[model samples]
Target: MTTSAILMYVDVWIVLCFYGYLLKIKKRIGFQLGMNISIVMGGMAALLSGVLLITQFPFHFTVITMISTVAGLTVGAVFGLLFDYQTFVTGLTNGIIIGLMSPMIGTVIERPTMFIIFLHGFFIFSLLTIFHSIKRS
Candidate 1:
């Protein structure tokens, strides 16, 4: 598969993971953390958008990637603030991290890089979440 295709899949999975993690820990975090998440997401989204524009990648690729990152971050943040500020921020933060990191990692692997990233992230964050919970308790 092409790099763009792999990146697209990576993006989708990243969003999924972002939501998954948020659902797991939203109630445990606070407003400050949520605000921080929003700021990080916005910054990452702007950076990614700038890179996309400067690099002049294919039109669809740029549009899809940017939209996914920006829209997901914005909507997630809004939803989090509306329903649960913590959840929104957590989701947006994770989404930004995944969105930004996936493309770079995808470029390194020849094939099946998306799967590797997904598994790697799942395991790492799963452990982190568990650790955070344990620490809190």
Candidate 2:
């Protein structure tokens, strides 16, 4: 298997282990904590998938990045839905924004820039989710 594929597996294991620990301490984590972790996990998965796409394609790099971004957003939306309704809205919004900007902003093969964009999306979505949750309360 490719290195990126291997890294994906490793990331999945890490997330699973971390969530398993959270499940053990769900009482302490509470809703907000769980929500934050869910966002982080979704974001990290997106970043990793972006990296994987880059590593695998390396050519037609722009298209690959865009494709990866779409894939990442799809995954994030799925995770958000699983997490909660607010997160679902946040993820979908974030994904749509990022997917639209992917072609324009990070067209080059700069991993750092791509990561930053992914992180930006993560933070924005998290903030929106939090705000919505707080408003609901």
Candidate 3:
């Protein structure tokens, strides 16, 4: 598969794992609600980013990424608080981390060395999962 396809798969896996973890912890919440909220926030971010990229707005990629990250976090946090206040912090934190890291990592791996991009995703995902698992215990 192409690098882009692999990255997309990884993104889907990350979202699924995150949603599953949230559902397991917030048993009172509906899985569909959590998934829909995540998808909506993600979609909005993508749309905004695409517009900025295509328009070649004044700001560079870094600035655009930062704006999108903040936007995603704000939206997710608001949705979380409205839906299930208990998961707001978790969702906001996860959104911020994903937002900030994803763009920076993408920029770094835009060169010929694509393995670094996969490594970046793998390491971040692994570290977060391990940290959360340990925290639960």
Clashing pairs in 1: 80-88
Worst 10-residue stretch by lDDT in candidate 2?
A: 98-107
Worst 10 residues of 3 by lDDT: 47-56
lDDT of 1 by residue, 75-134 (tens): 446535633656666757755655554444333444444554454455456446544643
TM-score of each: 0.43, 0.53, 0.41
> RMSD for each model, in Å, please?
7.1, 6.9, 8.1
lDDT of 3 by residue, 50-109 (tens): 233323333376676776577557655754654455446655765676566545444444
Candidate 2 Cα errors over 4 Å, as ranges: 60-83, 95-107, 110-137
> Between the candidate structures 1 and 2, which one is better when assessed by TM-score?
2
- Which candidate number would show the highest TM-score if scored against the true structure? 2
Over 14-130, each residue of candidate 2 has an lDDT whose tens digit, in order, gives 556654654454454445544555555555555555555555555566676667567556655664555567766666556545554444433454674456556546645754664
Query: Whole-model Cα lDDT per candidate?
Result: 0.50, 0.56, 0.51
Using alpha carbons, what is the TM-score of model 3?
0.41
Error of 1 at 101 (Å): 18
